[model samples]
Target: MSAFPKRDFRASMTWLHSWAGIIPTLLFFAVFWMGTLSVFDKEIDRWMQPESRYAGPPIAYDLDASIETFIGAQNGVEVTSLFIMPPKPREPYLYFYGVLAEEVNGKTYSYGRFVGESNEMLGEPQSLAGSGFIFPFHFKLHIPGNFGYYLIGAVALAMLVLTVTGVIAHRKIIADFFTFRPTRKARRVTLDLHNLMGVVGLPFYFLFALSGLYIFAGWFAALPMQTVDGVMGKSPVAFLELADSQSPKRRPRAGQSIAMDKAIMPFKTQAEALWSERYGAPVMADRVRIEHYGDANATVIVHRVFPGRRVTMAQDRIDFDYATGTVLYDQQATPATATRSWLEGLHFVQFEHWPLRWLFFAGGAAGCILTATGALFWMRSREKKAGAQPFNIRFVHAMTVGSVTGIMLATGVFFVANRFIALGALPPGIAPIEWEPITFYIAWLLSFIHAAARGRSAWMDQCFFIAILSLSAAVLNWVTTGDHLIKTMTTGMWSIAGMDLLLLLTSALSAWSAIHLRGKARQRPFAVQGDDPALQPAE
Candidate 1:
């Protein structure tokens, strides 16, 4: 029996899958890769920060002294609040980040998310304090927020639809369940792997699609209700109230700079006691904030990131009155908040032990492989279906290769550019754009041009380029940062050096694939006669 159940079912579903995947395949590849990278976003930040390798534990510091040093280093700087990062996977550096108000070119400016030593800022400013390209690349290709979210949501919904129709089209679902006939050429090979991987990972794909949509669900699904509520004039206040419910309230004017360290002591004591009794654990304190400086009723808030069952990675905000040093609010979260907390923890891998984080990392790599294979499958299928339509076939083929491999190549180059650009080795006038889309665009555009020119040879050529460039970037990082693989591993500086070793491993894989593709392309071509029953496999 056909999996499609009816003639129209097969026709309609085939139509849906083909068209849905065609329009967004390129964009989808980028989204999948970038979003995966956001998992280790902070590690990328640590890798880019050369000094972090030598910095101490992220939490073992006095907040008052750290803030004092940071503020004193920048003359006339006012501190709004500070975000303290806990010790990462293998990095010991405690990072203190804050915003600074400054006047640049006669215009008032606010600089955000700056990293510093106890109080000393770095000599040269780095782009967005090591956020790299992952965060913005996830939703937008650095596009405007409004347009980007809607576009991404649409793509995700299309993917959901594609997954459903795809399952319906694969008739030999269980018979070919574990079969991957890589020996077959082009379409058969591509189709087999595509269907196999897509069907096997179908559940995960659907979960990710659904979760991603829920992250932006309000935009598309609840539009009319949102509009109606907005028109009623209660939405703004409701939104603010929701935000306030989560955020710590601002302290009133205390009329003096009361000792923040003293104010936080009470909350810290209470929190430590609570954690020891309820969770039977030790807590790591990150930072404490004193809001509304010089105000009479100013409050102090202490934030800690600790390991616990309820909120495996929890941020407990303990508020205290600045003048009285009295505990104002304990702010313990509910069971539902813990569920949200766990989702966040799982998303970032923030509270994971080493084994779990590595497991998550492996899963992320699988996703990347899945994306690259899907693109390759598209190319091979088009070659079989498109005989006389050579130009259209080549166009899609080039795009598939260009976008998939191009992203990998560009990521390597971006890391290389980070080191070289800092030393003024690149050309002048290459300052990063406000949103930094141009760099990725230029790299991707060059890949398109190269792929279009090279035709069938593009895949092997790009793979070889990626292998060389990736290794080259790793070498360059070692030269500049002195945080190469050997030293980093030996010194327990895993984040920076570990990333380098991973790149080297990736390079090796790319090199092997390139060699394989190059050899395969040299084989003789075959064109099957449609009318020859003998040429067709036994049905």
Candidate 2:
């Protein structure tokens, strides 16, 4: 039945699967795991900052008043950006960004977190309310702008290709779907896991890759189209011009300011009315953007859309004059923009409810497991032949342990560092925001080196490391936040205490695997592949 000298389809796939699975394992591991935790990104911020506890009336002060007071408080301060918050369940803090000082003429005071009404610091100054570092590293590792994005794009493309090739090469899709022949040598065991996870998580894996790639499509895939539009007949500028042409261009006077008291509710209602008129049906308003602060002619733009629609498809761009608060420009989405809007919406998961978010999180975790198991299969399949190729095997092994076990440890370390730095246990001069990356990288590097030197024993070493890191993360939270497992359960502070329980689970699994592995080592080599004389070396 086969055309090649590899004989059986299974044998041919053995060769193809090794390379396909191994090549992108580490990159995908980083992507998937980070994405999993990113689902709870906001929760991580809440857990880190203990002082944000409040059901107090939402701060409804005048926008202009807050801006002027904050500006006056800091001489030579410039507000680069500001983010206003809606009445969300987790964090109701209105965020402000600008240069400021803790002391007059002091070394550019870096309290970026303590922002609110009249520049009156809302929460504790030393709290870790903004864990901005962890979320970004999950994608491109924050390598200056588009570079990280391109790298992720490359990996996503590889995932697409690998999935396609893997499906074609496998002949027993249905049979392998439920199979896990762990006793049939190391190679069989590895192959089983790779097939099982890959098959089971195929839909999720494809969506993640495709969606992730779409997010960067503008940078990589759509660049040529953008370039063509820019160069040909002034077409590129049409979209931006379209948005700007229909939107308000009114600039407010420099000195005058007006109160935006209860501005949000009315703005939302009116914007909805305008959209309903345009679209021939009602739509809900999502976000409000206030522009040109400290001016009489300032405008507010309200975004209205269907509740489950993508961000791009919103009947967006409604403007109102600040002084008279009269509607100026109201634009609705055309049928042509609907597809782009829907794709953009699908990519962002903007319409996700809490249940949907958790489901997304579960999908992300399954992707992580799928990637990890794929890497493990690559290593185990080559265990015997790789004996002569120690460094190559070691490198793969290191990546396997480092990315799989090491990242878990690194994440634990990150939370631990957050607790220490947030509680003021870490010394001064150490920038709190920068500490998360430093600790995570340090943990990753240490695990990589440890995995290389220790060989198969690195698994044990990493298991122990993970066990320690997970338990320590929980313990640190208890010590710093005064919230333990029982208290967290009773009071519903699951974010902080649930993180600890996860660590305990990780520890238990690692401990059990380590003991089993140690016992199995005496019978034969811990992981040995079949010795087939005809099996050719990797090309």
Candidate 3:
């Protein structure tokens, strides 16, 4: 129980906790904040894309038809492979992809949307939408070249350090779990919330951080496999193929090209009969993949499971030899890999459990609050030294304002812009859908500038702006789509209705916080989480 002198250990831990908590606070907030929003990413996709909100009878897709369409009219491009995502809730369109022959385009992929059972292709994506923009930003921060992976990995590591040191730094976590002081002075109230969020969210914080680290640094754990590959002088992809049996296995294209109908012959009936027996029931193919397009030896794979019925990221799939319909491999995760998949699934929240999804949202929001308050509390606690370091205090406050309220403001604007810009009125050269992200970044950059210029007053101002944007976006959705809350609620479109309800709640909360801050400012200007000498605690 006792490894080192308790007092000294606690002292060191407290010191570490304070700095570690603040150093990566901005990136940490961004990750959790975006990740929380990503919980409803597909729902948000429906909100952002009107075509995606189509409410029609369920439709089926034909792989042979899709393959025929791809190979027939792509002009000089020889299709090597295909991926098809069938219509699903909030995503009621068939998405089809074609991988070009290696010599044809050096292994490039092109994709389009198909509205119904017909094999006709709809042109490029209408918008980035939530799944494309918000979800990727959660893990990548929009950074390229795997740098984002490493950066996020580092932040997760810091969170683990902060979590451990916080446990050791303070001994009254149980008390703090039940403690929050709303009526006290701003500093005391902030500190109580900081402790309370830390206590109540300890498990959530630890598990998410741990899982996120493992996901990004999983390659680090594969060092042994990498070493084995290096020793064997094998392409690293072979290790991946061994690890994931359902992943596409490549066979060199034998110059003997075949017709599209012949290449897709094995998938239409024989494959379905096989999978139906394998699962002990009829199976609906979720997506299909192929390799060595139009070649006699091409491999075809079908993924059948969706993420709704299980907590794990469903990867149930079977591979087939193209011409013969003979089963090549069926995915079966080993115990170790299954555990890893669960850890990843837990962090990603891809499952369809509503209660757990909301809890994850709550935990992520709590983390945001914890990091924000912890930073503010540290600043207030060091008020004496703050005079000697005005620039640093101001810098920290600016970062907090920009990272917290600023990002929320930007997202609200993004949603609002999606409705306002639907009429396709962008100036020459810029596409209509392209303006969505352009507006988002412009709004975000301006938020940081506003925070820097307004100093301590920016928080309340931006809170009011967030409220305005949220309310505006919700109302505009009604104005444009005629899918008001009542209509969606009655029509059984709970996903859209739920998102609308959340928008209203966001507006209400932001407005209340702004009004509260204004009232406190009238009582003592710059009162809550601000530097005011008259409000300082008597030591």
TM-score of 2: 0.79
Question: Between the candidate structures 2 and 3, which one is better when assessed by lDDT?
Answer: 3
Best by lDDT: 3
TM-score of each: 0.82, 0.79, 0.86
Best by TM-score: 3
Candidate 1 segments whose C-alpha is farther than 4 A from its true place: 1-11, 55-59, 86-91, 97-119, 123-130, 218-270, 285-287, 304-315, 432-438, 524-539
In the range 1-539, model 1's lDDT, one tens digit per residue, is 65344546766676566666766777788777776676666667677656554533443434455445555655665554444443433444444444334443332322222233344444323533235457667765656325666788887797788778878766677888898888765556666767676766777667567657764663344344444334322221233223333454654454555444443445556656765676567664555555554346665666665553332457566777766767787766677666555554565455546666666566555555656666665554555555878888778878888778888777766776667654556566666422234555677788989999988788888899889988987888888876777788877666776678877988999999899988877773333223322112111
| lDDT value, residue 242 of candidate 1 | 33
| lDDT of the structure predicted as candidate 1 | 0.61
- For every candidate in turn, the CA RMSD to the true structure comes to 5.7, 6.4, 5.4
- 260-339 per-residue lDDT for model 2 (tens digits): 44344566578778777866776655555555543555566676543543335465767777567788876767888776
Model 2: number of backbone collisions: 2
Report the backbone clash tally of model 1. 10
Query: What lDDT would each prediction earn against the true structure?
Result: 0.61, 0.63, 0.74
What does the lDDT read for residue 411 in candidate 3? 91
- Relative to the true structure, candidate 3 reaches a TM of 0.86
